[model samples]
Target: METRLLEPMESLISAFVLITFLQTALGAQEFYRQPTHESAVQGSSIVLRCIIKNRDGTVQWTHGGFGLGTERNLPGYDRYTMIGNTNSIDVDGNSIEEYSLKIDNLQLIDDTNYTCQVSPGDSDEGIISNMATVTVLVPPSPPILSGKVTIPVTLEKPTNVTCDALNGKPKAQITWKKDDVRIMENTYELTTTQPDGKRVDTRGIVTITAQPSDAGKKIECGAWNMALKEGEPLWTQATLDVQYAPKLTLTHSNPDRTIREVDEVKFTCSGEANPFQITWRWYRNGELQADVNGYQYTIPRITRDFHGQIIRCEAENSVGTTAVEHSLNILYGPKFKGDPAHVSVDQGERAELVCEAEGNPTAEITWRRQNKYSVLHTGSIYVIPSVREGMFGVYTCTATVLGFHEISRDIYVTENGPPQITSDATQYASIGDRAMIQCLSISSPKPIFVWSRNSQPIDYASSGRFSAPEEGLPFGGKSSLQILDVQEEDFGIYNCTVINTKGSATLMIKLEKSEEVQMAVIIGSAVGGVAVIFIIVIACIIYYKCRHSDNESYAETDSNTEIKKRDKNESPSEMTKSTLMDQWRQDYNYRYSAEFDDVDAKVGNTSGQYVCYDTERYGTMPTNHTNGHLYGEGVDDLGPLNRFENSYSTGYIPSTFRSPSRTDFTSGRVSANELASGRTSVNDFTSGRVSATDFTSGRVSTTDFSGRASADLVEPFRLPTADNTTSKLATNV
Candidate 1:
């Protein structure tokens, strides 16, 4: 079949018409119906309906993607009974065209999309209905949450927590909070299942074990669901408190009472309390030591200064306080003194007694006499009526204070008298001889005598041959004592003691012996005898040996003198025989007598003419009157011959001379004529000569030898005038 092609617009219009025509020819029509979109809660009812445009068609309904017909109905539509047509509708009023649906007890799952369809005749295809989507909308009332209705209900016991909520759209979840934290499930019991088939929200009861910390805490319950706009909450709170009391105790502070200077004693007060503070205080001598909080008190070291002080310790807390006390007692020792206990005083004189004592609190003093009489009290001085022997015993002074007592030294009083002593021998005596010392002390009442040998007292019985004189020997109006035969043992101090009613006195006796006076007589006699014998022997030997030698040298000197005399033309008259003789005598006397005898004799003969004569007769002779005249011209007429005679008479005579007449001047006195003439007399010549017989007999002879010419004599008799008139005359001749 050849068909004509149509234009694009015509073809589109034709296709539309054909489709529409086909729809009309097939007897298919769309049902234009409004689905009754009614919303219900989880446990409410709902209904949906369809409206048909064609009168002769079949109608159907569906939910979500599942078909909905009479055999398989929609959810919650099981009990639906259709009230409209089941096939094509009659135009005028047949019961075959209208379509409708019903649902009861809707749930959350029941809300969905619905569809309605229509078929016009039996042999025609059905038509797709216009999409009149009927959506199930719910009006956000208070939610009946599923878990709240059918879920488990849980609660903790003894906790006042409400399992309820408010102001939620669908439903809100509810829970309990402790310390702002969720409670554990294990702490609560729960119940589930509701009376209706729909699920309900559950509310849990919160159980709490209250503690001190649980006071003033908050508990809560709430509900929520997906349909609710916000969660609903219920809240509650309470306050907690606890009560208690405190306990107390005490302890003492100081254990040792011996406190140092400025030392503190501490007392401690302690206790256990909930809300209280502790305090401390102290008391001393019933008075407060300080204000409160004074746990310690200090006391300086006590002296006599602080003897009766009292101290205490106190302990306290907020509740109350108590006290303990102690006392201080200082101890001191005793002291005593006495000055000049023993003193000396004259008879019938007054004496003093001094006593003192030192003690704590000033000791009380008392004085008593030796005779038990009270003398003084509480002072340092005591006096006696009269110082006598009866008052010579110990006087005691006692001091008592503060239950302590002390006694002073004993005081003794005495009187004074004269010293008594005597001597059996004089003050001077010979050495190695016996002497005596006697001593006696006389006091007013006849004091007792004590004898001392040296410094120590002597026992008369033990000392051999020592004797003491009778006591109370009256002499010179005083008593005396004599000690006999005192030896060197009595040389040292000897003391005499005397006692009387008044007092006592002491005296010392000393003795000494002389040595020089005893030896004077014996020394003088012995010295005189020895000297006389020594001189006699010396003179005898000198005369015997030197007599001849002296004569020969004299003769040789004369001869040599003549030779020298001729050379000088000097005369023999110028030579002096007396000078020669004196020289010879000095040499002989010194050599012989000084060597043999230890005696010295000084010659006082200044004329140098004195001869040492063995016999006293020769010693007085004028041997060289003519030589004296020559050499001693114009000199004094008196010669050594006169001096020799005077010395012999004065006991300077040699031992060889024994007759008493030897002491007399045997030389004849110069006559007045010889004095006037200045010449030797005939008697002087006789006195100058000595006999051989006298020498041989070892005695000085008094025989006259005036006419005898001996070889020993020089011959010339050239006498010079006393005035040197002859020397002038010879020079002139």
Candidate 2:
């Protein structure tokens, strides 16, 4: 009874659970409350939501055809998240919400469909919501147009152009526009994925043939997409360079290309091309002339080598090259060959005058007389069968050309004449002066002359006084006889005789002397010599008086002190200016002052004769003169020094003082050092204290100071001691 009751209860319970499962299964549903199709830019966040009103079901999300995550947890995707049950929150708080798919860091690959699903707790079947698209848009990159940097495009040869847009989502579309006008030409496109795994690449290409009118026209490529917010396409443009070979021409400024030899030539090459600044090259007879590079080529000097040559000009550019050619014709002016400007012929002789020249058009030759206006000959040679006196005028030979000056040669006909004197026959010359007698004559075969004195022949070389023309055959000959340093003996007739093979001529000259003028010159020279002696005696007398007075004006107080001053009105102090000789004179006593004049004597006079006295020699003093006091009074007795009778020596100067350069006597001044030997005069005052000590020690003889010891000379005397010490007067000379 218990087993039967349990079986019936189990059947009722199973039938009731089956009916509830069928009802839940039939009621399950899923749908996206947010947009079923949505869009978002790359690098943004998005959501795919499923809001199901069935309170007993669970929700899930999927990307494309793959599951995203369930309500519990996501397995492989970290950027994907699901929110459901009590943890679910409102997105914008305006619609029913459930577990929704939230994608962060949106990229280009995310531009696909997303779905949401809902199922009852006990059902195996779940309803999938319509896919919601997240279009992660990417603004297309600025379009890039690529082609050759320098393209030679033209209608004759068409070319292709390509443009590309990179890193854009949903592959951009490319179009072409030429010169702002849309082109309906076929465009090819290719699509590719970017390395980022996020964006797409799009490329477009088109073929075009540029026409002449299309040069400088702009061709543009535009990349566009639906996601563009500004509603304008990304574009790039390029300018077309229509190409064509240059139109070549060879031109010249001159109407005639024909030129003279040694004349300059210039040829210019002109060209027209789509691209300018084309290089130009020059060729001569197919050979390149590397020196020329400019648009205008010049030939500084054309020569015979360039005659009949072909000149070509080639203009080249990226498009193509063109060439032009010109033929040359070179002409030259007439040039004389082996022809002289002037020719001569003797009377009654045969004469042949020839003129020759070569030119492009052979020069025409003619002959005529210079004064007469008629032609003499018509060929290269102008012949005179027998030259006569009537043919003595000038004749001309002319060579002519169209573009040059006429060339000419002259033949001067002349006659020969014998020698004949043309000037007067008489000439006169003075004695004791040079004389010349000349014979002037005219001759043809030249002439020779002979000269004679008093009818005797004169040999010019032995006479050493005649000169004539040197030519063996002299024309307009001159013959002359000359007497140089003339004396009474040369006072005679001179004859000049000129002779040639044809004839001879003669001329004569007469010379004489005056004795009165010679006697007057002798008397004048004797008078001049006597006047010179009288002037000398007068100057000496004046000098002696002046010097005697100067001596009496000075006085000596003591040897140690300087020369005492004199009365200012009488004389100036001798010590005002010092010299080597003045210092020495301070120690001596003499009739005439040993003191030299400080003022130089007047020159160009006989005053120099009075400056010849030698003060250091021994001689007789003039009888009446002496120092102001007695000679022996107040003297410094250092030794047995002799008193000089003639302190002013007019005698031979010693070798020691005989310097050829001495001018002190004429200058009226003396050097104290000159009172001693020349070696001492130059070095004594400059030889330091050693020489001073030697002088004071009396080792220097009187001859050292006097320049020489005379027959009445004194022994060496001690120089006066200065404060009992030797004088330090000497130093380096």
User: Which window of 10 residues has the lowest lDDT sum in candidate 2?
Assistant: 600-609
TM-score of each: 0.19, 0.28
Error of 1 at 479 (Å): 99
Top-TM-score candidate index:
2
- The clash numbers for all candidates, in the given order, read 36, 13
C-alpha RMSD (angstroms) for model 1: 55.7
lDDT of 1 by residue, 1-733 (tens): 2254545668899998896775565454445565654544455556667666554555567667666664324345565544565565465433335567666666545556666655446545566554444323232223232223222111211333335433232334555555577776534323343343234435445544445555444443444454433454444332222212234343434454543223344444444532344355555556775554454454434454334565555554332344555564444434675333444455457877777766555677777653355554447677766754344334567667665445454443433433322221223334455544444232223345666756777677876655555443111112233335545654545565545554455555445443464467888878996996688568545643543343344443353532321232122121234433433334434432313221111121211111223221221211121221101111212243433344332222232322223222333322122211224332343343322233123122122111122213222221111121111111100
State in Å the error of residue 313, model 2.
22
Model 1 poorest 10 in a row by lDDT: 724-733
Candidate 1 Cα outliers beyond 4 Å, as residue runs = 1-28, 70-77, 85-96, 119-125, 129-733
